[model samples]
Target chain A: MTDNMYIERSCRISENTIWLDGAPYWKGLPAASFIDFAKEAFRLLKVDYPKFYKMDNLSKLVFLAADFLLQQQDKDGIALVMANRSSSLDTDIKHQQSIQEKESFFPSPATFVYTLPNICEGELCIRHQLMTENIFLVDECFPTETIEMYAAYLLRSGKAKRVMCGWAELFQENYDAVLYLVGPNGEKEHTKKNIEDLFR
Target chain B: MVELKEELKGKIIEVLNLEDVTVGDIQDGDALFGDGLGLDSIDALELIVLLDKEYGIKLSDPKQGKAIFKSIETMAAYISENRTK
Candidate 1:
């Protein structure tokens, strides 16, 4: 790795809390439910993007983290590499419930659209008009080592100028996301240790 | 007519996820799509499902939705005329 390689920025969202760059960006938000908390966060951000209301809980958590982390920058060819434990399980349950009953079988298109975890990548790309390399990995835990290696490879190969990597896990009402922007120069090292430490 | 418009407004807000909007915010003549209420194509599909599920009014053609869903006034009129349930 080059000596100049580092993490440019980072953001985390969990429960009713939000943190940016290892500091509290927003706190004391409603802890009622993830849906309620996401709504409250969307309102607080004052963003006019109506599509946010259409996203599932997992996508909403990841989108909000990306919104806080990368909204200021004008970036292109950004690679998105994310991993999650739950892997869209919450949405899968909702989608199953929607089609389970024969008497009340109703498969909603909106809910079905979010069955895949990578839909968050599509949502983020849509929000920023970014058409770039993106992948979503479902693992038992935060796969920081895999992310670090992948991001470094993409950067070194010149496939990506920057990498937005993180862990966005959502199951039921519990959610945790830690997104880091990795580039040639920053304040934090773009290593597995630093990425895993940021999640805590 | 007034009651149907109010009901349509409530359903639109609920189904379309217009959390910040209220029935009072929507007027009878205001356009439901584009600039008036800022609804998109996905919302159009949800409204179609709402018609069949809630009122038993099935629309077979997508083009018919444009005229029927022009405004709350038109939607209430179409539902009142065609709803079987």
Candidate 2:
């Protein structure tokens, strides 16, 4: 049953750089804010999806990195398992600010929509048309073991032909995204330790 | 009418996140949903919010959206007659 299980590929996105398979994929400018840097990376990606601009910082980070990973890997029957630490706190704060001001109590529907971290997952599924089972977990740290088990369970139980798992966390300007696809065959082993090591 | 159409077009582009589209790209009579501009249900909701926020027009019923948002021509006419802002 484990014959085909392997980590097909991986991508990591930090504040100023993007890494794919442990190497520098794209490096952004130093002085620019993370949001601007993400926009630069999106422009570099040259993806035609116009909805990227409307997304919150978290979704944009995950969207940019997942765009690369999904392009490089098989997307069919792929379930998404995403985790984050802040869990949409940045957008929550922005949404709160929109309504909390008594002088201008106008609550923006646009900012209010992105108050959940799982909305990033929904954005990814919408962009790629991935109708597979998806879940978003939150913890103080990267729940490496939980993600590994969940992805592995889905693959082994035939719930999904493949699994895409990662951590995409964004708060204020600090952000990180590391997405990896697991399938029956690949260069990297789909073990818990290997997945954890990729982050280091 | 021409100025209002232009203003509506600009608002639609800004509100809907039609990044690739410009005011010049939209024709007054062109359909705003399905096939023409390809906006979905979420964009429709955003447009409803836009009508209220920018023009001070409140659409209490979702069904009213279909007629009001049919085209830039219709939207411009409605806004001209009803907009409080």
Candidate 3:
């Protein structure tokens, strides 16, 4: 009944944890203080966290998910459709708060870069060399059927033989990820409807 | 002095995420860039931050860091000369 689903490779969360370390539970989350928020994602995904260089928190999610998918996906070109309530609202707030007092205003180069939500997609494309369609939507929650339908259309139309489609959401400390490998259902007529019904 | 250089090597390997490098892997005058350790610009920026945080030196210009960071030897020399703390 609710179109509250999306695919995900990973969902990097805030260190402002509100629940146990394992289960996906939630409460209000404090604003992320530094790029350290990425450490949460890396710890969950079990990737060796890079020691230095400045890839802010948002880039961390995009880069890690992209790397994971690239290694595992057998595809041609990449088509991505992702949903978010709003793009980088927390980062935008922090950036504005920084420059509010010109004397103390330090536009934190790190925070400023993530003010646009689509940057995550761009970061992935750059990392994986994906040159294809990427659409970022702002929705209160994920739109499930539309997500699969669109991803299917791309695959069926031969735009991409395989698509890494899903929802990667980070709201406060709550995070959710569902990444799917969509194609012409091997051997059997593994209809797209079956794939779409996965959430059901 | 030798202890400091060795410490610097360990920090460099740790900070750059240089997965295949080690203290013995790094020689006193071994080149750190362009084929020796294969570090690039992003690694350079990390080293700049390291200079500020660990050695009390600030390198605002990336170009100026070339000779100063030619190797662990050059880095220690510059740090010994310019470090404020």
Give interface RMSD, per candidate.
1.4, 2.0, 6.0
Point out the higher-scoring one by DockQ: 1 or 3: 1
List the DockQ of the predictions in order.
Answer: 0.48, 0.45, 0.10
Model 2 lDDT vs. the true structure? 0.87
Scoring only the A-chain of each prediction against the true A-chain gives TM-scores of: 0.95, 0.96, 0.66
Per-residue alpha-carbon lDDT of model 2 for A26-118, expressed as tens digits? Answer: 898887898789888999877787779888899999998898887756677889998999999999999898778785565666778899999
In DockQ, how does model 2 score against the reference complex? 0.45
Q: What C-alpha lDDT values do all the predictions have?
A: 0.86, 0.87, 0.62
Residue pairs that clash (backbone atoms under 3 angstroms), model 2: A4-A184
Q: Write the per-residue lDDT of candidate 1 for residues A84-170, one digit (tens) a residue.
A: 988888999999998799967666767888899999999988887777788999999987778888898888888888889998988
Rank the models by lDDT, top first.
2, 1, 3
Q: Please identify model 1 stretches exceeding 4 Å from their true place.
A: A1-3
Using DockQ as the measure, name the better of candidate 1 and candidate 2. 1
- The sequence of per-residue lDDT tens digits that candidate 3 reaches over residues A108-192 is 5445667887777777676567788888777776676677677767766667655666555654444544444555433323245
- The prediction achieving the highest DockQ against the true structure is 1
Pick out the ten consecutive residues of candidate 2 chain B with the lowest summed lDDT: B11-20
- Docking level of model 1: acceptable
lDDT score of residue A124 within candidate 1:
89
Instruction: Compute the lDDT for candidate 1.
Output: 0.86
Query: Cα miss at A6, model 3 (Å)?
Result: 15
Q: B1-85 in candidate 1: lDDT tens per residue?
A: 8988998899888877787799999999999998899888877888888898889887999899999999998999999999998
Q: What tens digits encode model 2's per-residue C-alpha lDDT throughout B13-68?
A: 88777778999899999999988898877788888878877888988888988999
